[model samples]
Target: MTRAKSGKSGKSGKSSRKSSISEKPSITADSSTAAKPSITSKSSSDKPWPYAAGYDNTPEVLEPAPLTVKGTIPPWLEGALYRSGPGYEIQKGGRVSYRSRYTSNDLRERYKKAEAITGVTFCQRDPCKTAFQKFFTTFKMAAFGGPKMGGTDTNVAVIPTINFPGLMDDPDYKKKKGKAGPRNLVMTTDGNALQELDPITLEPLRLFSYGAIDDSLNASNLAPAHPCVDPDTNEYFTVLLTFGPTALYKVVRIRQSIKGPEYEPDLDVLAEITSPRPTYMHSFCMTKRYVVVCHWQCDFAASGVSVLWYGNAWESFKSHDPNVKASFYVVDRHQGRHVATFEADPYYAFHTINSFDDDGDIVLDIAAYKDHTVIGDYYIENLRNETGGKPPQQAMLRRYRLRNIAEQAALSYGKKGQPQPVPAQIDFQLDESVNFELPSINPSRYLRNYRYAYGVNRSGMNKTLIYDRIIKVDLDKIKSGAKHSSSATFWMEDQCTPSEPVFVPTPNSTEEDDGVLLSIVLDGRRRTGFMLILDAKTMKEIARAEMPEGTVAPHNFHGVYVPNSVAA
Candidate 1:
């Protein structure tokens, strides 16, 4: 199956269940109105700036506390929404509980000490004041221990403990099996460490390693922040990177259920690729039959060892090279081998919206930027600046069609028998108005063709906070050469910024868009946060669970919603 066919309206895929949001008006405020819309407020003489207050040193809710509901929450919505931006909200038994905590509290304190900054970090100060210091720091960092970077800052993505062996050891965790079976959870960052959190309390248990799953993966110190899970097979796929004279990349797979020794998982090395220069990849793409690893133009300097000397990953990257095209390494899952390589224009992307096999071709959709400047856009100083920072940069949605990749891969071994670059054509590009990022889709539609995609809208200009709106787009319209008229919808409120929208489908639903969207919104005016629930089909507000007075939910990167049935 490929992208949905043309002539189908975006709303045609909605669930047959009646929507409570039908009577509510969709939020389509004009630019002027949306910018300065007034919100109810309690007067205060010293209110901190909204963006700064929400992002910097926000308070944490150590205990579960009930929140005030503004409207009716769907009784069918039973789960805890956890965000790596450091918080979670649970709705169960006609009550809602919100909690927030810092996963890297100790790590943050260690950096504050002047002489303790010995490990490589992402964007912290180098700490190497002189050439002699740089030499000693590099020697100490690369000596014996694993990649000493991002200490326990597993604030990126959330994965279920059921995906890995030996993680669900808690008898309580194992006994409380949901429809999918009993499981705990873990949070991950760019480093090798995974912080396991109690699914019920949201308390981090301990720091673990990828090596715990299999000894072969012990050499890897870096892995993709976003790992892929095949919905059909329940297999987990992640790429492990070991930096050395030659950077080595190994694509590994882990089975859903365990059947052997506690420590020994059904893990296997699917493919391996060695490169002289390693590129920084935040995420990758996967379909039912293939796993695609993208090597963009951004590469680490001095074969990645520079991170040791520079004291962080961000300081060691070489600038984007315009002449070098990006490479896509396609691994055939059934055959367990690297089958093809495709080339595309030099561009940087942080997330893959979705992917699927279309006939003989592979269709991959991603949010792309012209260069890597988007990385720097997240600096604390930049994010705190309301109007002085650089012009807001937006990521546009781009679709690539790798035509008959297996056949093209086979031809590479003919005659000269040397691999050549196979061209990957741009099948579609969304208009600039969308400015999409932090994309999400119906969980059931993952690794399969579906019409709707939900994400944040960052097209607003000169604003301190990013992503002022949430959006829903019809992928079928974009594929049918309707870049200008792609069916897109938005939900917005004045003085509120939203995190990524998570789509939770109705149980056993047939329609692709039959679900509700969940997002945590920081209310600028109130200086507090709330859980904003929207109708996935109409992009209209269904209900909201507001945090207690003076409670500010910190800005987060990614999140996951585990239904009570999965694991309470």
Candidate 2:
């Protein structure tokens, strides 16, 4: 086993900027290197931005190596902050460390022989180049039950076993029933397969499907990368899209405990939604009473059956239709039925911030885009381009209110062959200039009314690289009034791009912003990574935990912070 020796922490100089929130600080150099840290505002040069380093495949750090702590780590903060874009940082007893192992070793090897791979991936093209070759390969794979979905690259989001005793046998189930976060970490992608990992060592334990949880359901190809969890109920919710003669979207729910024997199938099919043309859904929203499943304008060609012919998800999507408005299917959680279907202007979104029941109305907040251009912009080749290829189209924080949902359902649903789509009111829209994505909020306020939201600002990053700063937005302030300058606060460093800022609340804190934001920042100049700790309220740097020597924590997507008791 490899062990990391404790190294001395370094301090950084405070920014001379007036506002505390948007300060650009510089890190002090360690004795090992004499390089001075500086910030860059322009990217006119033709050189490839170091930010592209994030796209490169990173080696696994399976051992728990101690990280060099630069400042005070909160005494109460202890546990594993599991990042599902493939890594995790464990902070306990004032010492910080990490272990990373993406469950795609086999997939990476296949990419080496790219043309030899058989699976259909989101952005990757089919190995069969020509028309005849594609037809032959797709026919063979679909006929022989070969891989169809984006298999085993479970690097999008990390879901913890918050509920579902059948998923894992926890000895202290009663004590931590609804009070804790995830006990066992599960890695998920935009596919059907779920990868289970040993929480401590980050080792791939087993590969299974939704069928494993319930025998009635077939392991569908398409599923939501981000599953919704009711923090209050401790129940988990996920939608499985099974494509066949008739495409069916089954919203499954798993509760805290099963009534029958241990490990017996515990999945409850909450609602089976039938759609002739199903749009691709990356994430969904869940409130106390309803689950909001929004299908954007990015519909699959031939009702998703063409995926077998094209053998590529992105290729299978029909061109965006401006006339087709995005639809939101509201499922009644308690009654296990579809309550109403609401429609908004055509848009695409990869992540939904939160949803809640406001009296009779179901309010939903999401990071939405105008079209599906954002999907192809993330191709590895474009990101690593010397001149920073095509600039990424940003997502605006949009709010859709399904007003008087019960009344709309009564008037429209079940009245005809297919119910007319109810118009969802556009309550609020964040400024078009502010580009936000990979949103995170206080988990406690997930299914309730919340004020603050943290995410990476990709506004002008195309010229430089990926996301260069972390942003905090006041949702209530935006709804009450509108000002891009006053409503949002940002924390940034020169040439240092941060990942998704995850808000970790202080224990027993009443204030929603009374917590710290944790993000893995890639310092482009030094070619290294560090765990950035920011004061959530003031948006100031609380501390920095530097990773082991030679380790660069590559850019990642969604992550979850597990408290000590549950993580252990």
How do the residues 382-480 of candidate 2 rate in per-residue lDDT, one tens digit apiece?
A: 555555366667898888899887886677556653356778998888886667888988878888999999998865743544588799999877877
**What TM-score, to 2 decimals, does candidate 2 have?**
0.82
Clashes of 1: 2
Q: Quantify all predictions' global Cα lDDT against the true fold.
A: 0.64, 0.64
Q: Which 10 consecutive positions of candidate 2 have the poorest summed lDDT?
A: 17-26
Error of 2 at 385 (Å): 2.6
RMSD of each: 11.0, 10.0
lDDT of 1 by residue, 253-352 (tens): 8763355222234677898977776777778999999999887766888877787777666667898789888988888888787778889989998788
In order of appearance, the predictions have TM-scores of 0.83, 0.82
- Give the true-structure RMSD of model 1: 11.0
Q: Alpha-carbon error at 174 in model 1, in Å? A: 3.5
Clashes of each: 2, 0
